[model samples]
Target: MSSVRRAVSAPAARLGLVRALVGGYTLVYLARRRKMLRKVVRTDPAMFAPVGPVRALRRPVPAPVADALNDATLVSTALFTLGAGHRLIGPLHSALLSWTLSYRNSWSMIFHTDNALVVHTLVLGASRAADAVSADALLARGPQPAAHPRYHWPLRLMNASTTAVYLLSGVSKVARADGWSWATGDSLRRQVAIDGVRKEVFGSHAAPTAYALYRHKALFTLFAVGSLILELGAPLSLLGRRFGRLWAVSWFGMHWGIRAIMGIKFRYQMSGVAFAAWFDVERLLELARRTR
Candidate 1:
């Protein structure tokens, strides 16, 4: 019981730092997509196949209304990131984000890549993530609460949620009829070829690396095996910090490799923000303190 408790517990600053990183990334991510989202709203109402929280809507929202909601979400997100009025703004940000992303996904294709980011944000927004290293902490009138299980458990939950996503992805791949043969590289090679073809057909440039490496059977075999290991073995990250860090770095590299091969970018994973929970992000705060 003691060991279990220890494993789940962490300094409040760790959660605070994670909140900032996730929130900041989300802010930037949404800001960059603002124009694109505006264009998406104006897409044909016939294309609106609602998913997630947006399923409540029977039809597409007016472009002006969507623009207003998006701008509101951005404002709440900024407040959430700053850890100001968090008791109210935190959950508000989460809900707004969820609605905005869900609505965005309703148009054409669902972006599975944003799942982890949304889950992480939801967890942080509902917890005491602003207890330290935040505007809330700095403005508090008295001493802040000491580290406790509440702060730590959310981190554990976030880590486990991330692991589950990878595990499910691995399971989906292996649960197919071909199953274990997926590691033999034929499937991966075919996928790369198909993606390249699709891009070319759509008037977009295909990844040059895909064409260049088409004949390298051995290389594709290695990539296939590595991907399976990375996804299926994601649970190993829960064992300890060393294992977790290794897992994070490995996944980070894997996303980059996928980008190079298929031109399909999982920007969150590539940016390293997706794996922030796996490390002691509080060290970043400590470093800043020392440098000051």
Candidate 2:
């Protein structure tokens, strides 16, 4: 327990930066998706197979109720981001977002885009993320701890969660029949072609670049091997900050490469939220201020 506490303990300032980044990102993300979420209210209630807390409801919520919940979430999220009443607002925001997203997915297809992010939000809300650089900090009359376990533990947990996702994906590849063949076989090219076909048939266009490379089995084989290595080696981030950044970059490349070739986007990963742990956000903020 002591070791665990030590590992997660972080400076209040660092936690403050994390709170700002994660909270701010979530706010912007919510705003950007307001239209899509609004559609959920208008979606057929017959389609709502309740999940999470909403499962307790015997019936789908009225559109007005849904809209009210959505608005409440946005407001709570803004308060959480601004560091006002974060201890209360943080968890409220996380819960509201989770409920909203789960409700949305329940009404339709399960979208994995926000899974990691939502997990991060819950962890952040439960931690001492608002202890520094926050309204709470300014309002406190007593001296705060220089560092606290609650501050950094959330970041570590978030990092582990994100890494596990990649690691499992890598394990899945090799866990299948002749998984090793992914590297030596034409699995990569075939998958790309299939993705292209699927997209084209669905009224979307496949990446022409992917089609051009489909004939080159050798290059595709290399790509396959690289992807496997990246996913399997995700735990490298647990070793140190430098390793974390390296893994983050490789992961970023993996997401971008797949999108470029398959036209499938992992918005959260591409947005840099998954790799927040590896960055010195305080330093970056200082640099931005100086440059401005």
Candidate 3:
């Protein structure tokens, strides 16, 4: 038990850095999508199929109310990112963010990619992630709290949460009737082909790479096998930092490849922010200190 605890132990600064990166990404994400979100609220109420926290609503809220909630979420997200008023704003930001995104997803399709971002935010908001490299920290009257298990557990949870996503994906694939045959690439190839066709049907350009590589069964097979390994082996990251970072880089590369072949973007994962907990992001602060 002691060894396990020690393995997960991390500095408060590390958590703070992750909080900044994840929060910053979400802030920018919401900002860029503000107009689209506004339009969504004005969308036909008949299309609203609530999911997540939004499921609590029997029907869509008034457009004005939805709009107000969106605005509040954006403002609070800024406060969350800066780590200002964390005690009061942190949990508030998490709830608002969850609702805002859930409401957005209620229309059309649910974006599974945002799941990790939401879960990570919930963990950070509930923890003492603002203890370092934050406005809250800067304004503190006393010395900063030393690194301890309290700081480390949240990160461990985040790491586990990330791993669970991939693990579940891999397990689902293997649990299918075809089982391990998924590694043969037939399913993946068909998925890419379908995605390309869907894009063209929707008046968007299909990924040329998908067409170019469509006939390369060997290449597809390699990609399929690699994907399974990455997903099923995600837990290896929890074993050590080196393994975790390597896995993260590999996963990031996989997302880029997916973007190229399918025109499907997992923006958070591609931005590398989704995997920030696996890294010593506090080194960025250390480097800044050294440069000064």
Best prediction by lDDT: 3
Cα lDDT of model 1 by residue, 60-150, tens digit: 8889999999999999889989999888888899999999999999998999998998899899999999988789889996575666798
> By TM-score, how accurate is candidate 2?
0.89
* lDDT, residue 53, candidate 1: 93
My TM-score estimates for the predictions, one after another, are: 0.95, 0.89, 0.96
Score each candidate by Cα lDDT: 0.90, 0.81, 0.92
- Model 2: runs farther than 4 Å from truth? 1-9, 141-145, 288-292
lDDT of each residue in 63-133, candidate 3, tens digit only: 99999999999999999999999988889999999999999999989999989999999999999989987
Clash-forming residue pairs, model 3: none
Kindly give the stretch of ten consecutive residues in candidate 2 with the minimal lDDT sum: 141-150
What are the per-residue Cα lDDT tens digits for candidate 2 across 135-211?
88888855866766766777888888888888898898889997678777487787888888898899989898898
Q: Lowest-lDDT window of 10 residues in candidate 1?
A: 141-150
